[model samples]
Target: MHISRRQLIEGSLCGAAAIALKGYAQPSRWQPGTVRHLLPAVSHDRLLLKASFGRPLAAPPTLRAGPRAATGVRLDSSAEFFSFDLAGLEPEHTYELVLEDAAGAPLCDPWPITMFPGPDAAPDRFRLLVYTCAGGHPATVNSDTDSPYFVSIANRRKMLLTGLSYEPDAMIAVGDHVYWDLRSPVGSVMLGNAPEARRLVGAFTRNLPVPGTDNERKLKRVVTPQISDLYGTDFRSTPVYFVQDDHDYFENDEATEEMVTFPPDDFMLRLARATQRLYYPEFLPDANRPAGLPSSGAADRPAGVSESFGTLRFGRLLEIMMYDCRRYMTLTGPVGGFVPETVEEWLMQRMAAEQTRHVVNLPSTPVGWSAGKWGEWYPDLLQPNGELGTARPKYLWQPGWNRQHNRLLQAASAMSGVPLFLSGDLHALGEGRIMRYGDLDFRGNPVVTVLTGPISSGPRAWPSAWRGTPPRTPTGIELEAGLDPLEKNGFSIIDFTEDRVEGQMFNWKMGEPVENLDNLQPFHRFTAARGA
Candidate 1:
């Protein structure tokens, strides 16, 4: 066991040579058991620290914290995470992150992160940059090397740089952080095995179909290759609050039962639980947790965890009610899916008691897309006569689900007196006002729903259903498409002050501002008075 340095070196060389001959060699630059790099260690004094790649190394490394020169010095553990406590820090403070390997070798070029204080600290003033659906196949191999799949340290750096430049308090990742393994017509590669440390595997892959390609044979070969190079790198970072969408759990328009065609059996349900553990940092209240069906006489049943859906309070001014529509929603069918009775009651109570000036409903899917024209009938759901029969309509823009959730939104807008609906699903951005009819619940009080498309995926046009919709202006409900430029990939920002709330959209690649107008197509802006 106590081998000499020379002997160790010689042995490593012989092993490497043998592997190279077998075409299974690692890069020469990396040696077996030699530490590659170290992440910035988490410290007690630090408000927040982000981990890019997966699990921290065995032995924790040292890092500098606090201000320069007279900054406080501390040691950090590699196991747990660091926090950014809003209470302790002031608004608009810039901090630098420096990472190194065990031997003190620098890992990445140094980067700076700025902390923005919330509206509480600045009197009804806060800013947030919203981004969703990024990270697919890269333009070239060079981009791949520079920025790998989910945990693209380079792309994150760019996002942070742009976010800081605009000085946002928080960033909202709408959903679809990673796509599960699915074949695509595009040449985008799929990730290999999921990381063992995190128990989740193959949850995120590149599945977006490549545009404008006619040859299907060539596309299949190129897209089928396993991307073993970028697996196991931890990409989930920042304080992201997300819900499970179809792509996040399975292929587009795929139902839970249809997912059984794939391996691992109940892929969608299993991945749903696994994804919650791997990515989310928060937990749901015990009362609302999911309980799997009871075991029968012959077999043991699978256990279940509560779905992630609840309200988050940001001071007294903002209340975010996040919904897990996927969990309760039914697949495309005739019998409408019902929100678990418990969830509906809870939502109703929250809306009735909400005292916050702004109540934001973050649903994974939008409320407006109707089925007749905007919805597509999957091959499996078609009949022999080529006519489509109604399947179980669980939140697939069926009239029932829409009416239910819309009523909840209407109540929040009327009771709390302030409502803004933030949604993301279709890779296109749009804004519109909700129309009300009879009572204040769903009739008179109107709510504004703004849809922000995918951050890095293909940009799509708003479905025809969203267009030609009328605005219930007196009730303050309207619908319009936000900044969604086909040629650009980007996100949206909301800046709030005591008097007004400023909504802006930005292009992540160019790091420029976009106007909130139809001419810009997908990108546009509109401001609502703080108390409106």
Candidate 2:
């Protein structure tokens, strides 16, 4: 039975009318006819498996592991997400997808998902491409097409596709997947004269414009910009473990205090929520409920909503802790709020339990960018502070809250013996080691922090380098210029094996490798014990 758009529309209207007349209500679990397509069931290759999203929604309409066929497994709700254990799949094989309807009928369309067997068993290597701050431009007075930014992002995406040809495990996008509130003129012709290109860029801006509107035309204009000359589909299908940054919410440095006073107009939040619905695959289950609602029983659950932060574990070797810094952070000036005390406590508890060999903290904001410089600038906002002008202080350059965040970092490093901290948001790629007492004090272990900047956004070079200064704490680590011109926007690929981890920062523009301070040509490799 082919379902046309008109038929689907008619069916939807009829279904709604039927429900209203019969006083039928949505069920806690989805009914067969509620949605057009049901998500595929998933299973992992190993018996010991754990998966989580931010919400209780079903898994994506499709699932991918390795290239092998995955056996159908029952999914159980763990409050945060649906978890599936793949107890009967072959090890070291790529598990493609297994589709099934609510009644367990095979959906018949198979999409391949790649999963790597644990490095614990053999010397297996997997590459992960991490990036952020794409899909929107700042409200600056630049005229040219800034093709470098777009070209760089396209190169990175191409590189990922190239890596996938080699079958890497996953790509971790460390937040800001789509910047919703960037500024661009409406219908303004592109100075570059690429009308189609201009339209694509314009679409992204219109989709989630700042001080948002409910009109569909405006939102569509922002997201599906006129970038036909640049590329098509906006790099949508690249599999990514996405976490939400401040841009995903509305603006930068937005916190509970600022939200209260300058709450996004209802239309803006709605628009943001809609964009999230369209882009992100899954969210934390707890974030599905309305704000301030009790966890156990919520009568008015918002439809198609989810949280953007959580954690996922790959056996006992690796644990990815994705944090929502924007949701809980405080603005820079008056109110000195940081992560809510409760979330902080939860994070601490999670960090204290140290079973994994490596822990990666993915915060939207770079954990340690200096106070003065981070975001792009606009002439309209008045400058407040010194060289670190307070102009547009409300959005970025939030130093006051760093006191609390710094402690959180210290605690995380102290508790978890994890060596690497992966982050994005500075729009520049830089790597540093977190030290203690002004020296290499890694609490009896070695830890390295790798920051990868924006995928497609222009690099704020001068301010980024100025802000890249290491913190001045007694435990402050020395900042060696790992890869100079980190300002050239790009992504970092980290390959992990049982014995060592190799980190490579790829320059998207030149399509080549970047060397660290050690002068290792092409790629930078760091060897450490699995647990150290």
Candidate 3:
């Protein structure tokens, strides 16, 4: 049953006739099809959701979260996006929420979905498929006639489908999910003044998608297809959690100058909120978080706990803390890194709680790697040796950032159970353990960090510190050698039981099974105990 690429062409883009092949073109917005797409599904506690995209006929559409049927809520935007949120659904249970146009025609292709497991149920084992930095600009930017490689795009779609084949309980997208390096605004147009800030903000957003704006339509054209191609039917079945990193939110690792000059209340603030509101799922605002969408409007900004950061508890086996590395201190101008103060406090509190047995922190940035002042780190930290225009960047080795990071290490050490941090951002796959910083006496909790990444992004330059024969860590961390730098284009499949966890990194060859990663090929594996 081998099919050639020529046989899979969808439309004239390849100068080929329409795919008229029923299933291939059946779920497209532009192609003559019955359905357009099944929007990326999201989970909130026990609730599971899915939506459809197509022409909105006169009567409002209806949906069923399995048997719980309700009228669809149309999200007003460039095009109609109807959603169904199935409340009170049992955790760890499966459902197929169907959407029907007024004529009773189902909008989604048949798919089975499961809700996030609840607190009361403790599954003996759970699996996760993790990766990050799969980003590229709009595909249309390529030639109207010539065929573009689309290497990253094709690889990303491949990665997701393969990850799903393992039946991972959830998919953790560790940020850089969407790159904002498209067309950024010029800095000269911005100033601290409200008017100038507004003008600059407008310029920045000219190419971005803002809900309810005409640009949204253009955005859906590019974005919707990407979602459909990458996630396919699995996104509807699994609980996929997205971590919004620098690229997903704004310009590549964007930190606006106006934001620094005027703080969070500036025009850049508005843009941040607007983009978030339109694109992502709803997040319950933490009370410790300030009363703003993007910025706090105050100098004493809270930690990175918002819709972007929260907790996911899985039947007492794991206390999962969501991490948002970019938003914590990126907007304030200072190159300071680490989770916000409030967020740290909350996570520590959770980790030390009586019921907390295993603690898991999922961050966008890799958990290891310290900086030596010469400026290779993105935001140069205060260094003994100066570099990067600003010599006082607050990198991990610097006192401010170091203290915050050390505090996290301290909490992890003091915890009675294993503290595991999983992350992306860096385009390399590796694992390490953070020892208590000697400076922080008695901070000796064993903290483990496993990094998976760059499903379709660049093969990053491995950090000099991590490239040693045995792999190195700045003073406070030690490398876990069995699996270090699975540098090929791949993703990590992690399976966890109550006492131990095993991970395998897999790469796919071109023309491999669309539904599988061909795991029999070159792969890297690692295992660790719950706590040592």
Computed on alpha carbons, the lDDT of every model, listed in order, comes to 0.40, 0.42, 0.50
**After TM-score superposition, what is the CA distance of residue 224 in candidate 2 from its true location, in Å?**
4.2
- Residues 241-294, model 3: lDDT tens digits: 667665554444323333222122333333444434333343333333344534
lDDT of 1 by residue, 96-120 (tens): 4445444655544443434333434
Candidate closer to the true structure by TM-score (higher is better), 1 or 3: 3
Please identify model 2 stretches exceeding 4 Å from their true place: 1-109, 114-127, 136-149, 152-156, 180-217, 224-239, 250-268, 284-306, 332-338, 374-400, 437-447, 459-477, 510-523, 527-532
391-418 in candidate 2: lDDT tens per residue? 4553443444545555566666675355
Which candidate would rank higher by TM-score, 2 or 3? 3
- The TM-scores, one per candidate, come to 0.55, 0.59, 0.72
After the best TM-score superposition of candidate 3, give how far the Cα of residue 332 lies from its true spot, in angstroms. Answer: 7.7
Model 1's alpha-carbon lDDT is 0.40
All candidates in order of lDDT, best leading? 3, 2, 1
Name the regions of candidate 3 deviating beyond 4 angstroms.
Answer: 1-45, 48-60, 138-150, 182-209, 225-228, 254-280, 283-306, 330-337, 354-356, 370-399, 436-445, 459-480, 508-522
Off by over 4 Å in 1: 1-56, 59-123, 137-160, 181-238, 255-265, 283-307, 331-339, 370-399, 436-444, 459-488, 507-523, 530-532
